[model samples]
Target: MTIFKRGEKELALIELKNITKCYKIGQIQVNALNGVDLSIENGEFVSIMGPSGSGKSTLLNVIGCLDQPTTGTYKLGDNNVEKVSDWQLSDIRNQFIGFVFQSFHLLPGLTALENVELPLIYRGILGKERKKRAIEALESLDLGDRMHHLPTQLSGGQQQRVAIARAIVGKPSVLLADEPTGALDSKSSVNIMSVFQKLNQEMGITIVQVTHEETIAQYGHKIFRLFDGKIEKIEVLNESLKAIE
Candidate 1:
């Protein structure tokens, strides 16, 4: 329940100015994001809420370096996203951003430990170090004993935890999540949010997630509401309610 104000304690981990994303749908230009400006500093837990086709995912994609803004300046850490080549953008994504999704996206055959090790393998990390880091990530999420379980063998909550461990194994500066708890049961959703709270507060990871549910969104420090491709308002939650223990 800590809302971060941009008064210069730390440099912004993600910054966007006048961002616009346009897509041509059947010869009609559609703006997914319209002149959006945002700043997310290090260690902030922010949530984006909006109706369908309201640009929540678009903004997250821009922040995660998955897509470039049609017109805007986006600075993620030290890289200017618009100026980077596709190859460099790929490298930047690996270096500074970790992504979690509504779907766990675990390989059906790989064990949790091996799934978590995928990122490091992509980075060409040595095998021994890769396994060690993956183990540590899973253990941090209380999945140490489940390391050998395959995706189908684990429960939904356990599967999502595995996805999260895989996302953070490389220690990215920011974690971008799209409907992270959307597929879980209520109790499982609460567990996932608590895990996110721990990661944001204890590990100092900046987390930005898009969720449609208010109860889930309340876990964030500040909720940014979007409407028709523009940010409607910023709601600072009631801080007295502490993060779920």
Candidate 2:
């Protein structure tokens, strides 16, 4: 697979053109996203910030191809994700997008390595190859020593790292994290942010994360501030806070 270099003339990995998402709850119509236009270039570390009902999660869902927009276009890589069938969207998500949630979401029954191997199992990877990749993924997050531990046995930050390992084990082109650090303490959050920075700067993975904490948002190169279901402003940081190594 070809990795996107920072200065190369690569197309936007995620492009949202006038995207909107509306949900009808009985008699009430809720607009989660309203004509939001956004673009995330390859190898970029971008953060989305907004208050409750601001459409941060909705936008992340649209970008991850997990949910379709009500109108407008969503281009993931070169594919128009909004036009794809549900099955095709699943394929695109499995092959191109990785997701991390606020809740660690690691299975209590499965060991860290086993949990990371789950995605590859769905892809029909063989046992030996799957094990190898899963170990590498865990190691990348400095979780090599805890690969055999269950989620309940690890710390909050360790569990989150395991979740991240699971997300990246598939070699997805983009990682969409929704409130990834919400459950961790300050030190743990910094550790996770450092891992994200290494992945973005060294491995060239495109990272789009939704964070409510301003300190956490400072880790990204750019911040998209959303309000009332639309992007109100974009702030480019002169210098992003370096993740603790």
Best by TM-score: 2
Most lDDT-accurate candidate: 2
Give the C-alpha lDDT of model 2: 0.90
Relative to the true structure, candidate 1 reaches a TM of 0.94
Write down the TM-score for model 2.
0.96
Q: Give one digit per residue, the lDDT tens place, for model 2 in 83-148.
A: 778998888888878899999888889999999999999999999999999999999888999999
C-alpha lDDT score of every prediction, in listed order: 0.88, 0.90
**Per-model TM-score versus the true fold:** 0.94, 0.96
Q: Write the per-residue lDDT of candidate 1 for residues 1-245, one digit (tens) a residue.
A: 12233233377767888899999989999999999988777778899999999999988888887898999898776557776788988988887778999999999989999999999999999999999999999999999999999999999999999999999999987889999999999999999999998888778888899999999998978899999888889898776436567
Worst 10 residues of 1 by lDDT: 1-10
Looking at candidate 1, what is the lDDT of residue 212? Answer: 96
